[model samples]
Target: MLRLLTRFIGLLLLAGGFIALIVDGTRSIAGGRLLVTTLNKGASEFFPALYQGLQNGVSEKSAFLWDPVFTTLLLLPISVAFGGLGALLIVLSHKQETTPRYWRR
Candidate 1:
């Protein structure tokens, strides 16, 4: 059940990543330069208040964590972040085979 849920969520995120990639590609073509939306920019645009609050909370908890770790993550291209996460989740959700090896048989 949990695996199913994880896979479903991963599929959704993968779709979102694909859409973001398409949008970025179109923007880049139109602008005559490479354009990519960062995770921070996308999150802020989608949920400004939530993003701001989260940023503030992280900064307050530990400036080092926020400045280095989170800043680097948030600076990644939105498509890369979403696609990477989705792929990881999908891979993690995969079931292992239980069949015995031929040598054991």
Candidate 2:
């Protein structure tokens, strides 16, 4: 029963981690492209002060926080770790089957 429980939890976590990874990866890629395109298009439309600030790279630091790729990358390690831990638990939960000496002919 304990083994089953462990296996179940392991499977759940493994699946969840994989799903998160895939979703985050896709979102990150799409978001990065969109951000670049938008920034380029909006560059000329910005007010003089804002345009100068952008040219001076003032928003670079804060922009990183808003980047989906960076956010997703941050979550990647956690997802990978959870998946690895779940796999380990699943392996440990496996039982070694054996037969009694009396049953061996």
Question: Can you give the TM-score per candidate against the true fold?
Answer: 0.92, 0.49
Error of 2 at 70 (Å): 20
Tens-digit lDDT track of model 1 for 1-105:
999999999989888899999999999999999999999898999999999999899899999989989989899998998898899899999999799889989
RMSD of 2: 13.4
Q: Cα lDDT for residue 30, model 1?
A: 100
Give per-model CA RMSD.
1.9, 13.4
Error of 2 at 36 (Å): 18
lDDT of 1: 0.93
Off by over 4 Å in 1: 100-105
Question: Clashes per prediction?
Answer: 0, 0
